[model samples]
Target: MATVTTRTVEYPADGLTMIGHLALPAGVERRPAVLIGPEGLGLSDVERRRADALAELGYVALAFDIHGGRYLGDPQEMLARCMPLLADPDRMRGIGHAALDVLRAEPRADPGRIAAIGYGTGGAIALELGRDGVDLRAIGTVNAVTTGRPGEAARIRCPVWAGVGSEDPIMPPAQRDAFTAEMQAADVDWRLVVYGGALHAFHHPPVDHAVVSGVGHHPRHAQRAWRDIVDLLAECLPISG
Candidate 1:
């Protein structure tokens, strides 16, 4: 069985105590660790489940909370809480750094072999960290919006994989094309996968809100994204077990 632990870390910048879930591999020594950033709703059961799945795959997974113990199902409120952080790149980078620090401090984690994965707004945060030169082995995102920061793509030294739904309004084809161009120009190793007929938040299962333009979940895309993430991590941060 996987060893799952829960803890809280204090973010001095926001003065908020963020909760996190750590999933450690059962019998590994100094395993590769992943810092997971939650979607717009913050840290929820869905994020915990993803961490547990990663732990089951013989990796140390840390799912960190960007929002401080507050979650609302309402879309407007969720946007209200997440938009401010997205608008300010510096603040987003600070939060990501704090979460990375928390992951690096874990005893079971190999600090040198760390990666990051995020969804939606969380994915944006991961991208910001990469832009700030976080030294991550790899970075992965799902349905993320690029803020077009100057020299951002050039700063990312690690491989990046971005997954998106073809139908996702937030990540239109033009944006994806531009992002790919930037990555290529920067010589950043990056790949993008666009799923046909899939929508945003594809990784969240059993979504109640089916509104195409609003918040919802898509389990099929989520599972596929997870598999891609595992493969990417194995390639970037190879582990011998």
Candidate 2:
């Protein structure tokens, strides 16, 4: 693995002091960057480590926050905050744009070669960014099959890839179908991967806190999803030496 450096970044978003984790690969040249959004529970070590891993693979990465500095371990609290936020496209775009601005402003990041990836609520935010006509090389989401405002998906200027567990009640077949329909109607280059026998948040590892029903980890599918994401990035935003 390449040497990786990390730091905490504080920025203003949604009237909160959002704290994010930035990871840079060992190099002086401006490199391709990726913005990673955390699940609705908020940013955690898992997302931070993901940023570090992306940096090791030679991409500057920022694991953006959702609920400012708070990690809501309580399921009710997470839903209470995220449900309404998800309903508002403008709010999601605001948060996403704030993080994108931070990543683009980083000295190590190449502003033109950035992608957005997220899980659950985070994934929804990434989609909102694309729908808002943000210039992104690629967009990837896991367990976040959210449809945007009417006809807004046509604004997505990059390839979109989404992954969902086949057994996930939160993102069932209907939701996945709706998301794909929107992508298709917009003529967006997109692909969806359904991991069989997995539940919601299957890409996420086992957590210590109590999670909502129909959410569990599938170690095999999780690894596969990661590889799929890496492939998407490689195809859309290749890293150069």
Candidate 3:
């Protein structure tokens, strides 16, 4: 097994000090990199572990922050902060860019071979990065099928993969259709997976805290979605094994 190392990263973005988690494979030379965006709440252990897993796969991975450095356990607080933030594409790009800068600055990151993945609001930010014309190998998101301005999406030069639960009220059929239509209209190479019987944030591990309606966890689907993400990375940004 390859050894991995992780560290806390503090950076500035949108007048806030963003705290990110950086994980790297045990090597000197640069390797393919992945930028992980966490759920709306913040950068938690889940995302940090995802980064570590990617690093173990021989890629430099950085789990970027969302709410500066705090997690919003309350559903209302999360929505209150995320809704307006989601509505602003520029802000999303700024946040993504900030994290990208941190990841790219790592000596072990191959700037040219990079991908971005996110959950929920973080996923939306990842999409925004692609729409902003960042040179990414691919983009993957879970429970975040947010669309951008048609003209802006046209600037995306990479494939996009999004996964959502079929029964997720937060991302219902209408939203899914709209997202797909936007992607199609932009002529982007995009794919969507609907996990049957899953709910919003189904990709996350079950938490003891109370969540809003339509939120649940599905271990099976979560694993499947993760596998899909890994496959996407292997296809687009494969590194020598």
Winner by TM-score = 2
- Give the clash count for each candidate: 1, 0, 0
| Total backbone clashes of candidate 1, pairs 3 or more residues apart or in separate chains | 1
Q: Candidate 1, residues 1-241: lDDT per residue as tens digits?
A: 6565555555543457777777777874788899888888778888888888888777788887877766556677877877888888888888788888878988889998899999987898899998998899999998885755867778898999999988888788888988888888889999999977777777777545423363346677777888999899889987763
Per residue, candidate 2 scores C-alpha lDDT tens digits across 26-53 of 9799999999999999999999999999
lDDT of 3 by residue, 1-241 (tens): 8999999999998678999999989878889999999988788999999999999999899999988898899989988989999999999999999999998889889988899999999999999999999999999999998988767889889999999999999999999999999999999999999999999999999887878899999999999999999999999999863
Model 3 segments beyond 4 Å from truth? none
TM-score attained by model 1 = 0.91
Clashing pairs in 2: none
Question: TM-scores, in order shown?
Answer: 0.91, 0.99, 0.98
Model 2, residue 83: displacement in angstroms?
Answer: 0.1
Which pairs of residues have clashing backbones in candidate 3?
A: none
Q: In model 1, which residue pairs have backbone atoms overlapping below 3 Å? A: 203-222
Say which prediction, candidate 1 or candidate 3, comes out ahead on TM-score: 3
